[model samples]
Target: MASPAAAAPSTRSVRLQIPRAHRGLRDGIEAWLEAERDQIVLWAPVAFGGGIAIWFLLPDARGWLSAMLSCVAVGLGGMATGTGGRLARILAIGGLLCAGGIALVWWRADRVAAPVLARPVVVAFTATVERVEPLAARDRVRLTLLPDAGAGLPRRVRVNLATGDAPVGAGEGARIGLRARLMPPPAAAVPGAHDFARVAWFAGIGATGRGFAPVTVIAPGAGQGGLRTRLTAHITSRLDGSRGGIAAALATGDEGAIASVDSEAMRRAGLAHLLSVSGLHITAVVAATMLLVLRLLALSPWLAIRLRLPLVAAAAGALAAIGYTLLTGSQVPTIRSCVASLLVLVALTMGREAMTLRLVAAGAMIVLLAWPEALVGASFQLSFAAIAAIVALHEHPAVQDWFAPREEGWGLRLVRGLGSLLLTGLVVEAALMPIAVYHFHKAGLYGAAANIVAIPLTTFVVMPLDAAALLFDTVGLGAPLWWLTDLALQILLGLAHLVANAPGASVALPSMPVAAFGTMVAGGLWLALWRTRVRWFGWLPLAVGASWAVLTPAPDLLVTGDGRHLAVRVDGGLALLRDRAGDYTRTMLAENGGIDGEPALLADQAAARCTPDACAVDVRAEGRAWRVLATRSGYPVAWRTLVAACRSADIVVSERRLPRGCIPRWLKLDAAMLRTTGGVAVTFAGGRVRTVRTPGDRHPWLVPATVMPFRVARFDGGREVRRRALQRRRD
Candidate 1:
């Protein structure tokens, strides 16, 4: 019924609305980018981390050459930037920082790579005990030994001496002589997994092994290591069981003392971080010290007025942080906390408010520059993420309102306090979720709930009582205080157990792709580092990453580095190839494959037909019937079984030498191949086989690949070159 002019106006209105909406969205994005401009400076480190992560992900390509090239590129970029505008200059600066990060990792790796012993050789040597920890479950005492001068050994060596007939005392200054089988630190169990060798390289530990007999005390050296070790030993010796284990772990940095059951419970309940003396413990100690100092100063009017109460409290807090660091062996996390806390104290003395992000960024840079390997460590990632999230949450106006003092009523104050705890716990748990899934392959479903109880208990009751107990112990009056501390810990431990037992306390997740993890990191950083409605755009990448994780495919086969075990995908779970599987194997199976249940019980679940000689299992993939066989070298495996497997099985796992003519058109992982590759993960898709190695030849610790035979492919106007595979060092 409308006229042509009316219809024209309506069409025009729709067209105008489209552009307006688009313009508004564009403006919103730009405004978000412009907001908190200063915080954009923090992206320099993020870019640097990205570069370092890239270096880690890529295979080693002539280490020294790559390092030199990176350095040169950075220098060239810097010089070239002088001729360009602001955008170019910014890009150049980012490049320089990123290149610098890569170079730092290379330099650190080279500096710490001492000559490793080639084989497990029995060596009789006397070394001073720099530090000592006992592993009673394994009937051995691990020692951080400083080899004597001219010992022709690495500066620092960690040796495990068996407590055979006589128990070895971990007394500092004691020079113990023992014959031990020493070998280089073990390699990574799976590719893209934790590299113990790299960790040892950074820690200055060149070798690891266990003694065949008990260690004999030969001489007492000067400056017996740390008083804290003795103190922890005394406390643990008295307490015994899980109580002593948790107590000793809290007091000292020796978490090995904790019982397996208690540790597992804590882990399941997402309370495992409490056992480590990290940022939380350091903050609590410093905070408690500051409060105590402030109260003491307030009690004396003259001192409060004349002494500068805040300065005194800050100084006390700094000293307390330093002492705790020392007591905890000056570990990486403790050192980071100490440095950050010192920064805070310095800010207080200068009368400048230290922004949390600035302090965190500075602290992270310091740790990375000092220990570049920490960038790969889960602890570093989790700790920094939690701190950043807390800072971001605090800056929210709603959070501020919720936390603000309610002068009207005590009930309101109580509600605000409880809300604050809940929010803090939720923030930390949410921030750590991606990291937890990537590293441990599980995100604690009830972690926030667990933390609601654990955080308050840890911050107030346990920490305070433990600190009081420590102070009392130092002066030989700790018994009653220790009892009180024990009671508190018992309650905390019980809570952990109950939470761990709760239904759906934790959810297993497939190993998230590296790309997905990187995306999530970018999203999380964007969200946490800015303050604008547009910052919510970070959720876009986060959601995409989450979707990718949910859809990613898991590996179908896994092999252990030692070639002593194999796990094949079966019936939506992994089936064990061996009669008995180790803890490491089980954990890797569950984490990497997202498989449930126990390893020892998995062999039967596989419905495998076995004899002392060999075992065979049927597999069906993509409408094709397949067979898998497991056999030992010396076993009298029937020829018919091997022949049938070679014909019908898509994959064969065996240590025995196969017949020359009976080779399968499928995949074969023999002992010799496993040795070369260490461990391997395999997947099948689109009727093709894909494999990934555990100790990929590209790692920094692995020997450089030797130039050998190779082939090149040439396409129309391009040429492709094949890089030779790096060989593993055979023991």
Candidate 2:
């Protein structure tokens, strides 16, 4: 009924509304960019780490190189045009940092490239022990051996030696000859699991094996393990068994000495960090050294006035930190903490506050540059997250106001200190939650409370006692100190077991998506780094990430890398198709399914119709039943049985490759197929099976194309080149 002119006005208004909304969004973004000019520098590590992550995701070096080049080109172009505003400049810097990160990690990987073992073979050689690391099994020790150059093997090879047959005390610089069957390092057990082969590759280790023949000591080099070994022996001898193991670990960074049962208890109760020599240990060492040396120097007033006491004391602390780090094996986490502690000493010399987010970022950049591969490691992630969160919380304006010292009674002061400790623990736990969930697939509910007591006990009570024991052992009076250390460790171990036994100590969460993890990291960094009110907006991404992590369903089916083990979801729990799977395999599969316990055997289930050669079962998922038929026998099966299973089942699995006549309705997995995929995880979404394969391509340390250790792809003169098959290394 309205006139055409009235309708034209209404349409015009609607069109104008869109532009107005667009304009508002643009203006808001511009304001945010402007406000964050100073804060954006803090994101350099994030940008750098992003590029490193992308390199790992791509299958080949060319893809990563091409991407890196593209980023550089885009960054340069952006820099040229960034005269417009701070936003443009920020984008340009981000691009360059990302390119730099990718380039650095790629260079590192290439530099560490070594020849991989082509096949399993028995070999005997006299090799020097480069390093000796303790394993969870007390009888086993991991030895890095430098084989003779004529052997045509990689520079370093790791072997797990049994104490029964191997040398009694193998340590650094010892030469030994042994015959062992060596094989290439292995891939993950299932899709989305940790890849030890890739880690081994970056460590310049191409082969791993267990010593089968008795180890013969060919030549014992000069004082192998030296002072560190003697110290470890003294600690362990004073406090034997698990107590000694914990003490030795804290003193010498020999974590493998800890009993597996106690380690698991500590891990589940969230006190495992105490076993690792990292920030807290390094901090205590540096602080105690500085204080003691400063007091001694201050006793002489003449020297105190002549020399800058703080600088002199800081120098002493720096030396102690470096020495302690080396004594403790110079591991990645310990080195990271050492670097940060040294930075604090540097700050002290310059009369500046050291505990800042900037310091954390700077230390990360250094570590990323030196050991770029560590960026993806759990130790790097957890250590950095905890320290960064604490520093951020310490610097918060609100926290500062609430924690300010006031004229109050001892009771009020003690209460305030306890409250502060509780708050810091909560903040650290929250910051580490996403990372823990991503890597471990579980979240410890009482980790904050556990840390409140364990951290102080380890840092204050136990470390000092352990150190005193070491000092007094030279005079043979360390028994008392060692006794005290043992008592404290017993209390610590008791707390670990008690907390681990509590109901809901840790809740298994579904496997996390990479996107969700990245989002959470961005959100956390944003919330921690920025001081403006706008920082509160970071909760949006955090909430989004938490939701995504919670909603991502567990895999319905998992196949092991060796094609011998198959786990399927059934009756709201996981079930192994066979009972032959090892404990490690069973635990990994359960973790993949977000289940707390090992999988039940399918053959033992009441409804599963399984024979000596085959197993057929029905699993309900996404509101429909899926029929899965899998072979049981390793030998050949009846042709008619295979055909029947393939025809009737929704999915089919076989130990041997299927014939053309055997086709399934949905999916099929056989030995031949599994060889290429390494491992496979199948999930149902919207009534469709979604497959996730690991080591998806031949990436240096993954699936072998031929009998060679693995198929490695590389770029040569802008063209993909192939390597001829290698012959036997020891003919």
Candidate 3:
């Protein structure tokens, strides 16, 4: 190097030598970061939810203090928006939010901690009803009970009772006596099934049970039979059949009167949200109240001149929204709507943009701060997702032009409004598809069309008429109103039935992994939250997640928690390992296998060897024929026959343990092994096995068998107490 400066490449020259692809990538990333700079705060709720999810999975919060400290440090590091580059600032704020979430969830858990039922028990007790919820079943009703003070019972318990067995006059806040069979909330029967026990624990419900004997109304005192209960009763009394149930649900949010068939139809048509009294109902009530306020104020010239009409209307709307939220059971969705509505009202009052991503995020943050656990609930997730999507759509420049109001005649305006409704419905259904499938294992394909009709029918016609009926009932001028309400409700039901029964109306999907669900959600948020051209990149991950979900294979074999039931994949669906399974067991097996229809009985399936006590079937798994054997009668099998079958079969499943010589070629699953595992699902695609209870993964809800929270309690059938206790201890 004659001259060091000349020999070495100049810094500018080196920078210029960068590959085109690399430079393009860099430029793209910078643009993305720049676009997302302001949107960082919008992601705060997502980070917080991630922390809550971690707590649910691990349930270990020993390091929460450190997380909190980190949050403080991160906050300090990113105190100013321009403290660092956009990326660094975003990372710092995200870290703070994540840490805050962890701290909040840990603290909330400790605060709400209560003892859960450790075992089944029988007790006769008197309790007061805090609230009542109607079940889908005709004769059954769910009651939230408040146990007597100083009693050796939980502070709160949820129990079911046969309506026919209870006092006919029983309503909210009535003291009742009953002899019930109380049991711990149940765990999942399959590996990925819903965990009732976990839900119960978070909800502070110590036990769940059904009344084994008739319930007596100790004192029909109704300290809680307030307006909601009275309104529900009045609605039901005026309307009969399914109409009454729909009317009551729309008015008071209690769906007990709706028959199972009608409810199922609504679910299949994707109109179940209407009965849930969510944002749609809340907005309708608020908007109506505001319009009425404006007109009434206009009538009074003096008041109109003195008072700010819009401001007064907003205040009245807020009050109406709050009252409606309380009237309609105050479910998670209703509360979320109330929060969002309150935010919008505040914004309007302050002369700010009322509908924006910031408003949605603020509402979500409020809910999460109050009830962090709600983040995991379906209602919360769906509500926020829909609102965010709608707002984002409106924010789009192209969409804005399409939806922009123009000076036009009433006819043109009506057509434009209808077009907007239809388009919005389609967008919402598309956005909600993944979530709906994940939770229900099905998606309503024609939901958009069905909702376009159902929403208007319910919101514009049904609810208004029902309100009018209730208002005019005090003056005996409500019969026509009640009849009009019923007519609209019946039309809505008819639409539900029509849409649900159509061919391919809903598509059943395979059970998807949590990873896929998270991926879809991330992609959706990306597309909806960002305004830059890069937002379309969200589709890449969305497509990947959707493919993953649709391609997930069903388990090849399944065993119940108690090893009393077994199933194997068949040609069309699944074939039961035993024919003597009950309805509940059959339904669980079918659902776990991703089969919409009932499973074929092993006795009925072709090419199956069967007996009263055992059945042998040859099925294809992993592109190979594998013979499976299952015992049905729960009796000790003949050693010679069992050994012969074991030698020939690839898998052997029996209620009793096999002899030492009885070895299957692949696996032997017996009751002794299943007891520890809880339930087992085997997939031959990659020879994977999943269990309901993994070894060493114990929690307060899924306690180990060898370790009892108290004693290894069991129901001793009418045995003498002392003798039974002594026998139990000795055993």
Measured by lDDT, the strongest candidate is 2
Tell me the tens digit of each residue's lDDT in model 3 across 409-428. 99998988888788888888
lDDT of 2 by residue, 23-131 (tens): 7776777788778766777788888988888887787777887889887887777788745766667678888998998988888877877877876766776788988
User: Who is ahead in TM-score, 1 or 3?
Assistant: 3
Give the lowest summed-lDDT range of ten residues in model 3: 704-713
Give candidate 3 misplaced runs (Cα > 4 Å). Answer: 1-32, 58-83, 148-153, 168-175, 409-412, 577-588, 634-649, 653-663, 698-700, 703-731
lDDT preference between candidates 2 and 3, better one: 2
Cα-based lDDT at residue 182, candidate 2: 79
Question: Per-residue lDDT of 325-385 in model 1, one digit per residue for the tens?
Answer: 9988788788888998999889988988764787888888888887778888898898889
| Model 2 ranges with Cα > 4 A deviation | 1-34, 82-84, 658-660, 685-698, 703-731
Residue 553's lDDT within candidate 3 is 83
**What TM-score against the true fold does each predicted structure earn?**
0.85, 0.90, 0.88
Cα lDDT, all candidates: 0.72, 0.80, 0.79
* Best model per TM-score: 2
